[model samples]
Target: MTGPTYRIEVALTAARQLRKLDHPARRRIQAAVELLASDPRPPGAKKLVGGEGEWRVRTGDYRIVYEIHDHVLRVLVLAVGHRRNVYRRSSGVARKART
Candidate 1:
């Protein structure tokens, strides 16, 4: 409630990735996603390295990769996966970044 609510949009790649997770993990991720709508940079969220406006939220072993578009007041989720390999692969959101 600190700022304007951000519209959360999950990319197809991210949605697909989310669908692959187990039930409990999916629930946690869903809760995290809801939080992002209210606070794009919620507590415990981290800015991902090598990208402007890119951030990550952790839920157990899973990671939610997202980008904040300030002007548009939107949050686009780029990827969703486990900690071990989430950063290793290029997500749709990551690919869209200039740097």
Candidate 2:
């Protein structure tokens, strides 16, 4: 018995970052993103501190930063990149989304 799924919206920045990834990494990350539609907080996902409702999931060395809007039932992907820089970049991306 699956529940209603959330709509996934990839921000332009995140989309661009995803496009720059290598083939296998891209595929794996895409799969993980899609899964959020059904389970936005899947196993291993973590709610980021000071992220203003943001959550993150990992796929290998890469990380996908996103936010779940329950009222709208949407999953907004804010950024995607290597673990080292994704967090730093996502905060800026998320700020842009607000304005």
Candidate 3:
């Protein structure tokens, strides 16, 4: 049987980051984000160290950082960017989410 899907919420900064990407990368990332609704912890998704309940999934050279709220059945997309900078940005985003 199918399970309930989680709601997906993208932070403003992450949305902006996604918009800055090329069409192909943007599409791939978008697809990955959508998949989180049904499977928040898909294969290769990893829990980020030092982050407050944060998780990440890879898509090409980019990464999608998010947090899964099981109680509310929601997935918050904290940041989306190149592997180099995504984690740095996500740490700040995760902090902001707590406030």
lDDT values for all models: 0.81, 0.86, 0.86
Model 3 lowest lDDT segment of ten: 90-99
User: How good is model 1 by TM-score?
Assistant: 0.85
In order of appearance, the predictions have TM-scores of 0.85, 0.90, 0.90
Q: Write the per-residue lDDT of candidate 3 for residues 29-88, one digit (tens) a residue.
A: 999999999999998888876677888888988999998999999999989988888867
Per-residue lDDT of candidate 2, residues 1-99 (tens digit): 998799999999899999999999999999999999999989888877655888888899998999999999999999999988897777553322221
Q: What is the Cα-based lDDT of residue 80 in candidate 2?
A: 95
Clashes of 3: 0
Positional deviation of residue 62's Cα in model 3 after best superposition, in angstroms:
0.6
For model 1, how does the per-residue alpha-carbon lDDT over 12-79 read when each residue is reduced to its tens digit?
A: 88899889999999999999998999889878887765676688888888888888898999999988
**In what order do the candidates fall by lDDT, top score first?**
3, 2, 1
Lowest lDDT 10-residue stretch of candidate 2: 90-99
Give the Å error, residue 68, model 2. 0.1
